[model samples]
Target: MKLYYSRGACSLAAHIALYEAGLAFRAEPVDLKAKTLAGGADFRQVNPLGYVPVLELDGGERLTEVGVVLQYIADQKPETSLAPPAGTMPRYRLMQWLAFISSELHKTFSPLFAPHTPEDYKPVIRERLAQRLAYMNQQLAASSFLMGEQFTVADAYLFVVLNWAGVMNLDLTPYAHLQSFQKRVGARPGVQRALQAEGLLGS
Candidate 1:
């Protein structure tokens, strides 16, 4: 497998997923702003959406989207239990959290990264993020991860998106549980490896 990623992008989640699964994979850096891959290949051809977090499977099948890619990697190594077994309640619940992050938390922050985002929109976005984060904190208060004591794919996705707090200058001081979540997820060997590989960490 090969993962195309840009430093600190959501692709970091996918990169970490592969590592956590003990999967052998190659990292191909993408210049997201330039829309070019490591080999000078037009990234548009790899993923017309021109986004980071594209994974090329061993058979040459390409997977785009972080949520899907993380799930795929987890499914590849079920023993890792990054996601619960398919067709089970735990699996569906994991999917539920993934969908929530993708639609609510992830897309909600999109405007904050936009060059033309209106000044007035910032507070509205921050409010929504805070509300969603509060709900998450309450839900996670009883468990170590979003799904419970076990670390799962949902944690990875949430951790990656939540890391954007710095990008948006959203202080996390008030979210204690969420802050703990960050520390827990960051301490994982695989996540640390991913961060180091992305140049976001040092050995």
Candidate 2:
């Protein structure tokens, strides 16, 4: 498989999932702003939506979206237990966490990154986003990860979004549990590999 990604974007979650699953894959950087590949080809040729985290399977089939792509990588190597077995209660919990991260956490950060967002409304948006993070902190206070001790794909997705706090200047100092959670996930070898691959970490 080949993963097309933009540095430190949500695609990093999928990249980390591939590594955590011990899958052999290559990565190509995408110029998201230009909507072009390193080879100068229009990214729309790969996905008309012009987004990163596009996984091209060996058979030429492509998969998009961070949630689906993370699950696909985990299912590829079930023994790795990157995710729970499909159709099971634990699997549903994993999906639940993924949905929450995508819709609640990820989407909330989108407006903060947009230049057109009104200055006065930015604080309100930040406050709402903080509320969500505080809830996550409460959840983590009871367990090592989102799903107890197991580090599932949900953690990968959440970690990627949490990393955005530093970039967006969203102070997380108030959520100690969440802060420690970030350190724990960052120390994982698989996550380190993904960060280095995307040039977001030092060798």
Candidate 3:
């Protein structure tokens, strides 16, 4: 299997999942802005949408979307328990969190990253993100992971999104639980490996 990723992008979640699942895979870096791969091949040919986090399976099947890719990686190694078994309530709950992170938290950050966004409107986006993070902090106050004590694909996805707070200058000091959550998750071996591979962390 191979994962096409852009450093620190949402694809980081999928990359982390691959390691956490103890799966063997190759990581290929993408130049998202240039719509090219590390080999200078046109990435649009890989995915016309020109997005990162496209997973190409060993069989040549391809998967897109961070949530789907994360779940796919987890399913490949059920013993790793990166995600709950399908058709269970716990799995549904995990899906709920993934949806929430993608639609509510992830998309909200997009406007802030856009250079075309009006400066005055940036605060509005930040405020929405703060509210979302506060809600997450409250949820996390009750458990070690998004799905209680067991880590899931949802946690991986959320961690990657939360990481953007630094790039956006959105202070998370007020969200005590979240601040600690970041540290705890960041310390995980698989996550550390993923970050290091992406050059986001020192070896």
Candidate 4:
């Protein structure tokens, strides 16, 4: 498999999952702004949406969307338990967390990243993000991860999105649990490998 990704983007979740699953795959860096690959080929040909986290399987099929791509990676190595078994309540819980992270948390950060976004409106987005983060802080207070002790793909997704807090300059010191959660997840071997691979951390 080949994963097309932009460093530190939501795609990092899938990259971490791949390493955690011990899967053999190649990572292709994408210039999201230019919509080009390292070789300067049009990335639009890979995913017309011009986003990262497009996974090309060996047979040449491609998967898009961070949540879907993440689950696909986890399902590939069930013994690794990156995700729960399908059709189970635990799996549904994982999906719930994924949906919340994608729609509630991830989308909320989009406006702040947009250059055209009005400065006055950014505080509103930040406030909304704070509320979501507060809720997550409470949830995480009860468990080591979004799904209790097991570090499922949901944790990977959450960790990546929370990382954007630094880029947005949103202070998270108030959320002590979250701060610790970041440290815990960041210390994982697979996550460290993924970070180094994307140049987010020193080798």
Question: Can you write out model 1's per-residue Cα lDDT over 1-203, one digit (the tens) per residue?
Answer: 89999988888889889889999999999998889987888999999999988999889999887888889999999999999998999999999999999999999888898889999988999999999988988887888899889998889889989999987889888888999999999999999999988888742
Per-model TM-score, in order, reads: 0.96, 0.98, 0.98, 0.98
| Higher-scoring candidate on lDDT, 2 or 4 | 4
User: lDDT of model 3 at residue 14?
Assistant: 95
Name the candidate, 1 or 2, with the larger lDDT value: 2
Error of 2 at 84 (Å): 0.4
Q: Order the numbered candidates by TM-score, best leading.
A: 4, 3, 2, 1
Evaluation by lDDT, superior candidate among 2 and 3: 2
lDDT of 2: 0.94
Can you tell me which runs of candidate 1 are displaced by over 4 Å? none
Residue-wise C-alpha lDDT for candidate 4, range 77-123, written one tens digit per residue: 99999999999999999999999999999999999989899999999
Pairs in steric clash, model 3: none
Tens digit per residue, CA lDDT, model 2, 79-193: 9989999999999999999999999999999998888999999999899998999999999998889999999999999999999999998899999999999999999999998
lDDT of 3 by residue, 1-203 (tens): 99999999999999999999999999999999999988899999999999979999988999999889988999999998898999999999999999999999999999987789999998889889989999999999988889999988899999999999998889999999888888989999999999999999942
Judge candidate 3 at residue 158 and give its lDDT.
Answer: 92
Error of 2 at 185 (Å): 0.6
Clashing pairs in 1: none
